[model samples]
Target: MAHSTDNVILQGAHGTFAKQLVFRQRFGQSILCKRPKKSNLSPTDAQLSVRARFLAASVYAKSVRANPELLVLLVKGLQ
Candidate 1:
C-alpha cells in the first residue's frame, strides 16, 4: 500500500495519468475516468514545479481529511 504522500507526489509529476493509476490501483477501475487531452498553455519549468507542489499539497489535504489517522502520523513525523 502506498502512503498518501506518495500518491500526492505522483499526482504532481503526472497529473491525471498518475491520478488515474493511483485511484485504479487503490480503489479499483470503477473510479477511472477518461481524461481529455490538455490544450497548449505555456509555462516555464519553474512555474510548472510550483504548480505541481500546489497540486500535491491540495491532494494531500484531501487525503488527510479522509484519513485523519494517517494525517496524524504524518504530522508527528514532521515534528
Candidate 2:
C-alpha cells in the first residue's frame, strides 16, 4: 500500500485503474494499492444454501414492495 499527498490529477481521484491498481481517498489523502487477485474457490454446500435462502428472501421482498397493500403493512409493522 502507498499514500499520496500530492499529485494534482490524483488529488481526489479514486477507483481501480488499468485493472491492476486501486486508488482511494482516505483521511483527506489519496491512497494507491494493487488490485487483489480473484478467488477461484467454489462455494461450500452451506454457503450455497445461504445464497439460495437470500435469493428467495430478496424475491419475496420485491414482490411485497410491488404490492402496495403489503408495503403499507410492512411500514406499519416497522413502527
Candidate 3:
C-alpha cells in the first residue's frame, strides 16, 4: 500500500514484504535572482544555496523522490 502525508510519501516494496518510503524535507528556502550582500546574505539565501546543492546531487541519483518513512522520521525528530 502507498500513503501520503503533508511532506512525505510511503509505499510498499515490490516482490518483498518490506516497505518503501519517500520524504520531502525542505533542503532549504528558495531564493530569487538578486544582487549579493556584503554581509554574506540572509538566512534565506543560505538555505536556498544548500537546497540547490542538494538537488543538484540528488538529480544524479536513481530514485531521488521523497521517502515517506524518512519524512515521518524527520518529523518525529523535529518534535
Best by lDDT: 2
Candidate structures ordered by TM-score, highest first: 2, 1, 3
**What TM-score would candidate 1 get against the native?**
0.37
Q: Please write out the lDDT profile of model 2 over residues 1-79, one tens digit for every residue.
A: 5544568998888999999999887888888889989899999999999999999999999999999999999999999
Question: What CA RMSD would you report for each candidate?
Answer: 16.1, 2.2, 20.3
**Residue range 26-78, candidate 3, lDDT tens digits:** 33422222233358655788889999989987874424236666666666877
All candidates: TM-score: 0.37, 0.78, 0.24
Candidate 1 — which residues are off by over 4 angstroms? 1-42
lDDT of 2 at 8: 97
Candidates in descending lDDT order: 2, 1, 3
The per-candidate count of clashes, in order, stands at 0, 0, 7
Error of 3 at 43 (Å): 6.0
Q: How far off is residue 76 in model 2, in Å?
A: 0.6
